[model samples]
Target: MTGGPATDEATEPYRRRIAEIWSAALGTPVTDAGHHFFAGGGDSFQAALATATVRREWGLEITVQLLIDHPVLGDFSERVARCVDER
Candidate 1:
């Protein structure tokens, strides 16, 4: 198994990308580490849009449920790391 610790280089870009998507979709500056997508007035439709945007931007397959399951930037970054490891 190649699964191990993810370095900052690998995680930082993902976090930034996620933050950009959230900020653009919500029209708010999400500069915090504890921002919640759904709790911040992000509906299912908006989440779906985010999923598509992430896929297009990162070329990674992510479902809306996955986005819902991991709302915060930190958790979503972990998920992206796991997906990269899996691939």
Candidate 2:
């Protein structure tokens, strides 16, 4: 808890949102951080679509390669948060 509860709490919504996006893209309920999008029957095309959706939904600029590089929702969210913070 060194990061503080407030910081942790702030990340929760982002995590949940990313999870929802992942679930929607995969067309299944996914609640685990270990879930791999591509391994779970998602293709590059799907990843591209998902990236576009995330960009539009989150208002963050992201590329399909970024989604492919970070397939897990948690990782993607962390990356996106970093990108947002940098901007």
Q: Point to the candidate with the largest TM-score.
A: 1
- Candidate 2 lDDT by residue in tens digits, 1-87: 244666556566777877777778778887876678888878877787778877897788789989788887667767776777777
For each candidate, give its TM-score against the true structure. Answer: 0.81, 0.80
Error of 2 at 14 (Å): 1.6
List the candidate 2 regions with Cα displacement exceeding 4 Å: 1-10
TM-score of decoy 2:
0.80
What TM-score should be assigned to candidate 1? 0.81
- Predicted model with the maximum lDDT: 1
How close to the true structure is residue 35 of candidate 2, measured as C-alpha lDDT?
77
| Per-prediction CA RMSD (Å) | 3.0, 2.7
Q: Which residue runs does candidate 1 get wrong by more than 4 Å?
A: 1-9
**Scored by CA lDDT, what does every candidate get?**
0.79, 0.76
